[model samples]
Target chain A: MSTADRKARDKENLKALILQGAKKLFLEKGIEQTTIRNIADEIDYSVGTVYVYFKDKNAILHDIHTIGFQELGGSFTELFTIEDPMDRLRKMGIFYMKFAIENSEMYDLMFNVKAPMEFIEHSEKEEWNEGVGTFNALKNTVAQCMEKGHFKGHSLEPLSFMIWGVVHGMCCLEIRQRTKGVKFSKPETILMDGYHEFLKIIEKL
Target chain B: MSTADRKARDKENLKALILQGAKKLFLEKGIEQTTIRNIADEIDYSVGTVYVYFKDKNAILHDIHTIGFQELGGSFTELFTIEDPMDRLRKMGIFYMKFAIENSEMYDLMFNVKAPMEFIEHSEKEEWNEGVGTFNALKNTVAQCMEKGHFKGHSLEPLSFMIWGVVHGMCCLEIRQRTKGVKFSKPETILMDGYHEFLKIIEKL
Candidate 1:
């Protein structure tokens, strides 16, 4: 590659490295406790180098938030190969819940935390492309299911959203400790058990 | 009333007043922005006085969390008057959404915020009684529906939780700006529209 092209590539690689470190620290210690200095230390870089790449912690958080969506997309890779929309939708939720449970902190940052949204609000474009892409994928699957004569009397967008709510809510409650407050007969398996109930309902419809 | 009885009544009244002021500040500013000092100032009391009634901000948050449950219960008072378990269960979700949208900040504090949960952890009881009560109400309604031959093949607890997840997830998404991130075709009425879709699905069952 030319010198200028190599320089641009190096900058991109370093930015990815910084985000990787930030995401790890965020998962380990949570977003509130993790700092730019901590991120620099984790990546074995100077604090000045960290600031040189990103404006502030919010910038790091926003970048990591996008990375989370990418990871979620990675999980969905196997989902698209399935020919049946209903089956794909079901597996999609299973994958979504698995992602949330496995990466609880990142899921919280993506769905619940305010800093990433605030960063988007302050940015020039002010569009949540990552979120839109994720939602669209689900909406498309639901639309296909509708075409197959499943979900009669349902609007595509709202039905897709409701299904999202079911899985997301289960994960949110468990991650936020709200489930602990309620005495479930089986607290440990409530998320999966709840999901199965939803699966049963959708199969009939 | 006796002097001791009068003193008890006065203490209860002052505690309610403090919570009212604190909730106002919380709704107006936000949980992070509202402080004990802010609560005191809003109620025309001293910070020390605020502390005298509640140990810290978390304690106040716990009390307010209970009050949120009480307000939610008030909304459900009309629910039990309906005879059909399935109908009651449907309206319960509607009322729950109405409560969430109308009291968005309080809903966030009850479900998403960590402070009240932290306070419960530090307390002797170590239970989230308020959350328990709210979940029980929903569970009871679902159990009644099951008794009437609805959800014939589903387990009671998990189905109840999934149903709860459906409504709670929608509210959480709306409250946390996730709905805004996804460009829903009908952003303004997605919650209700999504819920109507759920209602359609369950009516068939």
Candidate 2:
């Protein structure tokens, strides 16, 4: 390989390593506590070298967001492989909730807090889109499910938005440590039941 | 009334007024910008009076939370007069959204950020039982509906939590201002569609 190609690969690897270290620190210590110096230290690199890749602290956070979204888009990719359109739609919702429950901070990055608009506004850079935004994937599934004669009562976009609303809302409450008062044995079970509720309505449609 | 009773009532009213002013200002300028001194200035009271009632900035936040929980709980009092369980559940969810929509700041206070968990752990506070906490009234309605042979399968708490998940998930995404890339014509319509899906499982149950 050419020297330039090797250097590019090396830079990419370092970026990923930095992101990995940053995500860990941010989740454990919170965004305020995770410093560039700390991330550089974690990766056994100098702070100046870290600055070479990222312009500033927010830039680091933006990269962390990009890394998170790329992985998240991959997570929702499971919906594309399933054949039964109806089942795919159901699984998509389940996967969405499952993703939120598993990688909470990442989920927060994707949908909970504001994403600096640059990331959401198309200036997000190529690495951020993965296979298009996960929202599009979710929308396509909903549209396909609608075409197959499931969920006829609502328009595609709104329907998908509502589905996300319920899922995110429940998970947000659970994550916020407020669910203790709600008296649920498990939050997932509720999600499943709610999913079934939606399934029932769609079948009727 | 007696002079002592009048003084006590005036003190309570002034404290409430200060709290309301603080909440309004905090949302306008953020938690950091809204200060005790500023709050007192808004109400034309001395900073000393503000400190007499509140130990610190966090105390004012605590009182605002107390008031917010009461307002959130009170939203249901008008609905309980309706006897139809299914409609009540539907309205409860809709009202949940409306509450979040109308009282944006209070909604932020209730679930978006962490509050001082002073009154929630102990049951002595008013609105602690029945329908005070956001989960209580919703769960109570859900339990009643389940008992009436309306919806089946899942337990009420999890179902309630799931319902909340989707509702808040949608709201959170929108309210947090990160839906720039997300394409949805009618955001609420997309979100509430989860309810129909929810009812499907309920019917089978």
lDDT of each: 0.92, 0.68
* Model 2 C-alpha lDDT per residue in residues B75-154, reported as the tens digit of each score: 87889998987778778777777777677676766676654443454335433232235676777888888888865555
lDDT at position A86, candidate 2: 76
Candidate 2 reaches a DockQ of 0.41
Candidate 2 interface RMSD (Å): 4.4
Candidate 2 stretches greater than 4 Å from native: A1-18, A40-56, A118-132, A185-205, B1-18, B32-59, B117-132, B147-149, B152-154, B186-205
The model with the greatest lDDT is: 1
Give TM-score, chain B, model 1. Answer: 0.94
Per-prediction DockQ, in order? 0.81, 0.41
lDDT of 1 by residue, B1-205 (tens): 6999999999999999999999889889988888788889998999999888998888999888888989999999989999998999989999999999999999999999888898988989767888888888888989998888888899999999999999999999999999998878889999999999999988877
- Superposed on the true chain A, the predicted chain A of model 1 yields a TM-score of 0.94
Candidate 2 per-residue C-alpha lDDT over A69-171 given as tens digits, one digit per residue, 9 for 90 to 100:
7777777676678988778877777777787778877766655554344443445353335323666777777788778877655666666666666666766
DockQ for model 1 equals 0.81
Shift of residue B90 alpha carbon in model 1, Å: 1.1
Q: Each candidate: how many clashes? A: 0, 23
* iRMSD of all candidate structures: 0.6, 4.4
